[model samples]
Structure formats: C-alpha cells, structure tokens
Target: MDNNSILLIDPTFDPASASTCNLLVKVGLDSFSYAIINKETKQVNAVFDEQECDNGAQKFAERLKTDSYLKLPYQEVKFAIHTANTIAIPNDLYNEANLESHSQFFTESHSGNLYCQAQNHFGFTTIFTLLRAIDKTLEEFTYAKKYEQNAGLIQLAEKLDGYNLLLDFTVASFNVLFIKNQQVVFQQCYEIENTEEFNYYILLIINQLNINLQETALNLTGIINKGDEKYHCLLKYFSKADFISVDTDLNQEVLDDMPAHYYSSLLALNQCV
Candidate 1:
C-alpha cells in the first residue's frame, strides 16, 4: 500500500512448476506472506511458509517477468543468493536499520567467473562487489579468490562499477565502492554469523575504510531471513541511511492454486520470452 516501498517476491520451487506465478510479500514488521492467485481474480490469497520457496534471489527476480499478476504498479523486484550454513547477518538488524529509498539487485554474473553486478532502479553498473566480508587490510586488498568462487556470482560482481552511482555506497554482504575518482575501487566484503557478528564486521569496515558516516551513506540489505530478531538488528545498526528488501511480483491468477514452493526455478522459463 505504501508507494515508497517496493514489492518483494520469494519463490522456493524448482522454477519449472506450473504456469501459475507463486510469490510471497511482507506486509510489515509482522512478516505476513501473501500470494498472487491470478492476474484477474486476485483471489485465493493466504499466508504461506516463508522458507517453503527454494528460489534464490537470482531465480526469484527472473520469475517476476513471467508471473501473471505479481507486477504491481510500484513493485520493484530483486533477490539474494547464499549457500547453506553461510550466515551473512541477522534479521533484526535488517528490520531496525534506517534505510533510504534507493535500492538495487545483485545477481551472479551471466558472463564470466566469480563476479557480481548491481542493478538499481536506473540501470546496470559495471562494478562487481565481491562478498568477502573477512578480515583484510588495504595493503592486502588485492583481488584474490578467498573462498571457492561461484561462477554465477563472479560474473555478476565484475560488472557493478561501469555505471553511475544512482545514490552512493553500494550495499551487499560488504560495503562496496561503485565508483571512486572515475575508477572502480572494490572494497572489503563484511561477513558475520549473526547480528552481533554483523555489528563487529560493520564496525571493522567503517574503521578500516576510514568511512565517515556523517558524510557517506549507510546502505545495507540482507539475503537471508532466519527470523525477525536478525531483521530487527540490521534495522538498529544502520539506522541512518535507507533499507530496502528484494521480492518477486507474481501474476494474480497463477497464485490462486497455491502451488508448492519447490516450483520456482521451473517457473522462470516465462522470462526467456
């Protein structure tokens, strides 16, 4: 109902499910999930499982194009991807963070190796902000592969800095530099197991990067949703800048059936058109 906020859709299926577009949306702090049953009917709406959908951020974004009715007028779609047992941050931080209006989508690059690209409301940028939120100094900031790289994610990161900075500092697992003095300077990616860990990492980045909170902006977004506690932590930690979430927009008619969550990947075929 809020014009300033964007629509979020999370599909947890294999992407090859029925033509019906199934997605979930967060109503508010309560995290009420809603589904699009049909493009015309708009019926059969109900609360569903938050984790039922297996579709990751990339796969979920692709689903928006095909969904019969997920596309609401002001809904901007985006997604997040992560491996199992890999905790980026908590949900409380995400919920309490004072966020701005501008947001973007980062997907595993379609082109090359472990790179990523940022997609904001404007257009695609050419800078890839790798998710390396580990301990690193400026002297050790060489572009090295710290963990086993994901080919899908690598290509996406490589193309993040070629475009204009719609707002300011890019937010991913780590605080990123979209453009610096006409050149793309990749910053360290922050990592943490929970909210406390996230705070430690965030502070570490601020201290090491010589970041001025008053001057620069704090833009943060998370891909995982373990619970409201973690979300609340993120909201409180970065309570200055804007906070936004990535979701899917599905056609209304497709959702009436209320299909299972595992059909997300199979549903993306509609985007090929």
Candidate 2:
C-alpha cells in the first residue's frame, strides 16, 4: 500500500467472484478511491481510498499497473472524476451543437473533452470537462462509463427531503450541494486550506442562499469526521449537522473499524446509473 492509502477487503471476498462484480473508481487531482461490489447482492467486497495525491492521473495509471484487484474482470466499470469544470443545464436548454457556449457557465476556463450525462429525473443534463490525460488513462478499462463527481451526490440527494445541504470533502477541498423541496438550489466545489477558510465558505453560503441553518438539514460525507474542526465549525451554525447515512444495503463488515459515513458518497457511486 502507498502512503495515505487505505485498503479494506472483506474476508469472504473471492477473486473468482469478481466476474459478477462492478468496479467503481472515483479519482481527482488530490484523491483516488475504488470499490468492488457484488452485482447480485450489492455487497461491497473491497474498498481503497488514497488522499492528498499530487497527480491523480499518474496515480490512477500506476494503480492500473500494480493493483491486483483492478486487474480482475468485472461485469461493469464506472468512473467518477472530481472536477470543478462542470455545469448542469436544463434538459430543454441543452444542445449538443452549442455545447461550446455552455463553457461560459464554468467558474474557470477549461480545455478538455466535454462529456454529458442526462439526469432526466432532475430535468437537466450535467456537462463536464475531462482532461485528455485522465480520459486517455481511463481507456485501460473495457466499456467503462465515466461521470463527474456530482453524479453520486446528486443520486444521494434524490433520496432526501426538505431543505438539505450535502457536503462531500476531500483533503483540501469540499463540494457543497444545496437542495430545497427536492430540487437542486446550488452546487459548487471550493478549495480550503484551514478551518477559517472553511468557516468563510459556510458564512458565504448562508448569506448567499439566505439559508435558515436552524431549520435546514446538514448532511456530511467523505473525509470529514466527528470532533474535527470542520465538523465543529459546521455545528456552530447548523445544529442539525450529522453524517450522511448509507442508504444502500452494502456489506458493512467490509468497512471494518472505519466510519461508514466517511465513504458514504464513494459507496453511493454504485447507485449512479
């Protein structure tokens, strides 16, 4: 195992059964994670998460060459890449011919291949940019489906009700999605260095959205934990803050002594069809 990496395999996991499993990989500039799940039972056989990486593409490529789990044949391979260069356009307003025009909505300029996912349930299509290197590296998998990071979070949000704030954290960045009455109100990823910066964003989000912290539910997932400064900071404003629960019937034993909420968003990748 590499530094900052954690791998957990269920005692009952059998390599021979991989042919009936699905491989889900979530990679970004700073982190990489993957889960092997039984297609029939939806049991997570294994999970691997590595954070604070310098070059995600290079790290993924190296894992393809070294990780034995990745070599096993699986029923399906799905990838969720983390990137801020993503925009969700209403289904009626989306036009493949005018995709270039949509880049204006991006917070930062990006030069990469555009990929779109039709989120018909939400009446919108998610358009995101994928770096050429990352796209090329993903070619190692056969018939792999690619998606942006928000796909899983969006799927998870669909199950929630009322005013909800979903936060998914990485080592130095966090993604926030606000949902009101089952519709997405705001979603964005922010880079933060310390607790103060994290607090700044919380305040900004509250003022920008006129959020009623007392009434709204704050659900957290990924990298964050109880008693952490970030968690405490969130509690200061939102007393309803709590870790998001895993809604799927996954094998909890696979997580062993780890907190299930820490990987709830990652595990939700299995639900992103």
**Reference-based TM-score, model 2:** 0.93
TM per candidate: 0.30, 0.93
The count of backbone overlaps in candidate 2 is 0
Tens digits of per-residue lDDT, candidate 2, 1-273, equal: 867999999888899998899998888657888999998877889999888887666788888888999989899888888776888998789998989999899877888778888777677888998877787777777588888887778888888889999999988888899999877889887788899999999999999999998779999988988889999999899875778867877776888688778788777888877
Please write out the lDDT profile of model 1 over residues 1-273, one tens digit for every residue. 233222333353322332343333321111212333332233223233232232323223433355444444311221222322111112233321332111122333222223223222222332233233211111132332222112112222333334311111111232234333333333333333456776666556557756544445433332333244444554454444433221235443433444222122212211211
Candidate 1 Cα RMSD after full superposition onto the native fold (Å): 16.2
Off by over 4 Å in 2: 96-98, 107-111
- Separate clash counts for every candidate: 99, 0
- Which ranges of candidate 1 are over 4 A from the true structure? 1-184, 187-191, 223-241, 245-273
| Candidate lDDT values, in order | 0.30, 0.85
Name the candidate that leads on TM-score. Answer: 2
